[model samples]
Target: MHKRKISIYCYLVSAAFIIGLLSISMFISYSKDPTSSAKDDNQLEYVTPEEVGYSSEKLNEA
Candidate 1:
């Protein structure tokens, strides 16, 4: 009888632990900002190497 009680307690504890882990994973997966991966409208425009005061030939050599 004592062994049966111990087994039941262990099973409940293990099940509770698994449930807690699943809930935490679900929360993390769902809590992310969906728009964070989208491109922003304020992005910088493209510029050539020489326009930024750097030589294109030297940049290519390195």
Candidate 2:
């Protein structure tokens, strides 16, 4: 029973250590480039129908 308790404690400590390491790495990476994980705020270029070979005049007639 004593050995089993020690084993459980070891497992818990190992899991905690792994989690801490992962958290630290994640924090460092995010701190370096916080915007890297965020969605792009840049506006997309607007294209006209004529630019893609679609006639605006034909669409207007329809």
Candidate 3:
């Protein structure tokens, strides 16, 4: 029937619209700056306890 065909066409168009929106959103999310994820100004620094005035022997006892 013609009505059935129209219903199918509408369903296909709606599905395609949803897929397009999802792909656009995904692309926007992935294209953002990678460094923007860091929320803090103080990043972790690699340093030994001895440099901070802590003895290695005392750490090993714990």
Candidate 4:
């Protein structure tokens, strides 16, 4: 009876430990992916407004 109680306790403790570890792993796994600002750092080429479609005259009105 004593050995059985100890074994049960040990099993419960191990189960709790495993659950804690699994929760931590899931939390880490679901966290946002690492993003790099390097790709987002794209520099657009400067161009005259007329080159696209906006007229310089209309731009002056604003």
Instruction: State the C-alpha lDDT per candidate.
Output: 0.93, 0.89, 0.91, 0.89
Candidates in descending TM-score order: 1, 4, 3, 2
Give the candidate number with the greatest lDDT: 1
Tens-digit lDDT track of model 1 for 14-36: 99999999999999898957769
Backbone clashes under 3 angstroms, per model: 0, 0, 0, 0
TM-score of 3: 0.53
Error of 1 at 7 (Å): 0.2
lDDT measured at residue 6 in model 2 versus the true structure, 0 to 100? 100
lDDT tens readout by residue for model 2, 1-62 = 99999999999999999999999999897775755676557857779999989999999999
lDDT by residue (tens digit), candidate 3, 12-50: 999999999999999988885776766655778878999
Worst 10 residues of 1 by lDDT: 32-41
The TM-score measured for candidate 1 stands at: 0.53
| Cα error of candidate 2 at position 22, Å | 0.2
C-alpha RMSD of each candidate structure in angstroms: 5.9, 5.3, 4.1, 5.5
